[model samples]
Target: MRPDAVVIGVGNPYRRDDGVGPAVVARLRAAGLPGVTLAESDGEACALILLWQQRRLAVLVDAVRIRPPHPGQVHRLVTAWPVPGPLEPDRGSSSTHTVALGDAVRLAGELGRLPARMLVFAIEAADLGYGAGLSPAVERAADKVAAEVAAEVRTWATATADQGP
Candidate 1:
């Protein structure tokens, strides 16, 4: 069977690191993988679930605000997100309304609509003000994260191919 998967780059381009996800999609387009479908999202739950239907895997990329160990760190989540508490509303740039990427996955699971496997790439942002440009730090980090996302995609494709019946 052919491998079926989708990579969802989730963010708004004008909002610093929030653009990382979309940027990855653009990079992947240039890389030209044969079997994968790419979708650009605003991290909206409806759009993600719709795009992910029946796919073996879905990779989501976006900007995040992490705590302590590395307040401003780029990170990846390769499995289900740990359950979170009530979401604090965002004052700056985020691509969705009300719910977020993490919550969406959880909600999907609740609704029996979750994908087979899911992964997330989240980069720390220095700023998320109303703007069309990225901070120097976020810009550089996006390039690195995009490479990582591409490598992960290649690995997923290879592994899926190897598991043929």
Candidate 2:
């Protein structure tokens, strides 16, 4: 049977900090948690919604290109939509090839495709230049975020099982 929840790391690994999402996905797979599907995508909104369809919970991690002080910082937003309201904005690191995260979430919400419970982890990015390596700071943060995500996945899995099919 498929897991009750899904954690998706979205970003392009070729772009420095932008690769954080996929990096976290790699960590989760290494840990090998049962019943939780670990996956990575190109950070496209529609694809994200499809990947998370009908799942009870979804955790999404992405590299955010915020300003000075905010760069290298990690923030989590729990909202049905992805607007920047109280949340800070992250710039597009790679070439414009996809929809903004907020826009995607809004589209999903409008189309009634968002999961029941969702958590978005946005890590401020330092450099987005064309490269396959992360800045020292963002690289350090990858592990911390990965660990937190794994623990959350485990907790969510347990809680979901307790509720029963």
Q: Which portions of model 1 show Cα errors greater than 4 Å? A: 1-3, 67-72, 81-97
Per-residue CA lDDT of model 1 for 39-113, tens digit only, reads 798877888888876778888877766433232356666655343542221333333335666677777777777
Q: How accurate is candidate 2 locally (lDDT)?
A: 0.78
* Residue 87's lDDT in candidate 1: 29
Lowest summed lDDT across 10 adjacent residues in model 1 is found at: 86-95
For residues 39-82, write the lDDT of model 2, one tens digit per residue: 89996777888988788888988887654445557787786564
Top of the candidates by TM-score? 2
Cα RMSD of all models vs. native, in order, equals: 4.0, 2.9
Best by lDDT: 2
State TM-scores per candidate: 0.81, 0.88
User: Against the unseen true structure, what C-alpha lDDT does each candidate score?
Assistant: 0.70, 0.78
- Error in Å for residue 59 of model 2: 0.5
